[model samples]
Structure formats: structure tokens, C-alpha cells
Target: MTNISRSNYDPEVEESEYDRLERRWTEQLSELRVTQAGTQIMMGFLLTLSFQPSFETISLFERNLYLSLVITATLATVLAIAPVSFHRILFGHPGAKARVVSITQVLLRLTLILVALVLSGTVALIFNMVLGTTAGIIGGICAVVTITTIWIALPMTVLRKLR
Candidate 1:
């Protein structure tokens, strides 16, 4: 997002569309690999929380919130890693590059949305257990709004301006 990073924007680089797609796919896949690792770790931790000794004392609302967070986190992990499976299943087949890259792009976008939700839910669940429901709602709303603005809206605004 800075000028130092923007120095690589070689608008003059000549390449076929297929080649561009291949490059983009590689770059996107690498980015998603980092995301997938983090999401998997979160999912694993969430899955095991119910077994903790102190977990049995939680209120029903807190227990339900934790379950919902685990489910949402699981979905985020699935969405984050789905494109990898998609690529392997179709790799190098005729016309697969374009199709894989296009689908992966959409999946990546959806994965980010899921990640934002997972983060918001985590914040809400934790705050609800620790501070109370009102604080939980406020924390969740703040997290979702901040992530949406920074991750989605800011990029969109910049893209619109460039167009």
C-alpha cells in the first residue's frame, strides 16, 4: 500500500493473459497459504475449548456463543483452503488455469469475509464471557467495521479512484 511496495507496478510489462493469470494465481495462493495456517490454528484451538475443566461452568449463552464461534471459524478455515483443493483437482487440465484462477479469486474474496466474521465472533464471544453481552456486541461491531473498512472498503475506494 505504500510507494515502496508500489514500485513493482510495471504497467509496461508485456505478457499474455494466460501468463498473467498464472502469475496472479501463484501470488494469491502464497498469500492464502499464510492465511490458511492462521485460520487452522484458530480452528484447532476453538475445537478443544469445550474440553477444558472450567468450561462446564459457563452460562448457556456463553456456551452457545462459543459453539457458534467454533462453527464460524471452521467455515473460515474451509473457505480459506478450498481453493487449494480446487487447484490440485484441476491442475494442468485444458483451460484449467483460467477457470481455476477465476474461481480461486472469488473464493479468496469470500474467505476474507468469513475471516472477518470469525474474528468478530471471537471478539464477541470472549468479551461476552469476560465483560458481558453489551460489551460483546460493541466489540463485535467495532471489529467487523474496522476490518471491513480496512480490508474491503479501502481497497474498493482505491480501485474506484484508479478506474
Candidate 2:
């Protein structure tokens, strides 16, 4: 894909608002492709966990945690992937790009939530199996902190500073 340079953007040039939005959204779709691929790989791994022998040895709480993680991962996959599928279905259709991008934004936010949940659950499950509830609690807290630091706090701080 060719990168859109600052020269390509001219605020003074008049275009239909819809067309402008579509162009911006198409750019966003390109940016999100890498994020979609990473999430899909993680989701694929989570999906296959139920078939493992260790899964049977997991406690009821741990099993529930795993199930929740799987569900979250599935949702995350769907959300992360929606943009590509949306673009494919709506290609060449007038007024589709803006709508696709709008839906994708919502889905991307949902994907973040699911990703955090899956990460927390996975951490808890591993600790639960190896060292019981106390360790699981500590691991869960660590996971939450990690997600918050990387996904929420750092991004918010950087975005705010940029603004």
C-alpha cells in the first residue's frame, strides 16, 4: 500500500464530506491489519486449548476461567477481523467506507476489552494450576496491571501528551 503523505492532504480542497471520511477510514483499515493478524493468532491458540490433556486436570474455577478466556478471544478475533470482512463486502459500494470504519472503531474498542479479559484469565489459570488460588490472585493482579500499563495508561499518557 502506498503511504498517504501530508502533501496528499489539502484542507482547502473541497470534496464531499462522505468521500473525505471514506478516504480517512480506508487509511485506518490499512493501519489495523497488523493488529488483526496478531489477535487472530492468539485467538487460534486459545480455541485449541480445550483439546489438551491438561485442560481436563484443571479445577472447576480454572476451567471456567479458560472458557471465559476462550469466549473473550473469540469475540476479540471477530472484532479485530470485522474491518477486513466489511471492506471486502462493501468494496466499490457508495457510502460503505464510512460505515465500515465506524463499525470497526466500535469493534476495535470491544476487542481491547476482550483481549484484556483473555490475558487476565490466562494468567490466573496458569497460576491457579501451578500454585492454587493465592498465586492465581497475585497473577491476576499482575496481568491486570500489565494490561493497564501497556494498553491503557501508556497510550492515554502518550495521546494526551501528543495533544
Candidate 3:
């Protein structure tokens, strides 16, 4: 069998640790794309609610709740999309790893919050339109609980285990 030279196999122009971080950031951006799409769609739908015929018929409290959820969705969409643009602007900076990691953590938190808001909003909206106060409250609670479990609890548990 022919043997390869170590220097040839592992080139002198090897990637620095920062290049590894940049690669990881690229991967993280790809993953965030899916979440960005979903939240943007949800925010779009939330925006259209004001023009709907039924929107005027809802109680003041429900209207306020709907508005709050829409704001959350909008914020979430922005946060989710921040990292991509942030990297583009800060690509060559020496502090890329620190910035990227900070942005990633913030995006994750925003995503979880947005997930809860969107889920609760959708559920509460449906119940408000169909089954009224009791059902809306119940549905919102259920949605929050689900988000906390899958988004917050599960990730925290896995991270804790890793540590």
C-alpha cells in the first residue's frame, strides 16, 4: 500500500480555531433559517388579523392580547434573523466567536419566547373566536406549558447533563 506524507495530508495552511468558529456560525445560521421562516409567517398572519372582519368583534381584552402576541412575533422574527446579518457585518472581526456565541444564545432565548407567544396566540385566538374565555385561557396555558417543556426544559436538561 502507498503511504501519504503527513505534511501533504495535513497542509501547513490549516484552518485556525477562529475559522472553526466561523464554520460553526455558518451551520448555526442554516439551522436558524427554518425557525425564521416559521416565525415570519406567523407574524405575517398576525399582521393580517387587524383587517379581518372578526377582529372588530373581539372584546377589548382579547384585542389587547392579540396585539401583544403580534408584537412578540415581530420581535421574534427580528431576533431570529439577526445572526445572519450580524455575521455578514462582523465577519472579519477578531471577537467573532464571542459575538456569535452571544447572538446565538440570544436567538435561542428569543425563539423560545416567540414560540410560546405564537402558540399561545394561535390557540387563544381560536378559542376566543369559537369557545370564549374559558377555552382561550385553557388553550393558552396548555400552549405555554408545551413550549416550556419542549423548548426550555428539554434544552436546559440536556445542557445540564452535558455539563
Q: Which model scores highest in TM-score?
A: 1
For 1-163, candidate 1 gives per-residue lDDT tens digits of 3364564565336668877887898888897998899789889888787888979988998888888878888887888888889889998799988888888888877877778888888888788777999999999999999998999899999989877
Off by over 4 Å in 3: 1-16, 156-163
Better of 1 and 2 by TM-score: 1
TM-score of decoy 1: 0.87
- Assess the local accuracy of residue 142 in candidate 2 as a C-alpha lDDT between 0 and 100: 98
Clashing pairs in 3: none
lDDT of 3 by residue, 1-163 (tens): 1276664463324668676666766667777988888888898888888998977888888888888888888888888888878877887788877687678867866786776788788898778778988998898889888888887799999889866
Backbone clash tally for model 3? 0
Clashes of each: 0, 0, 0
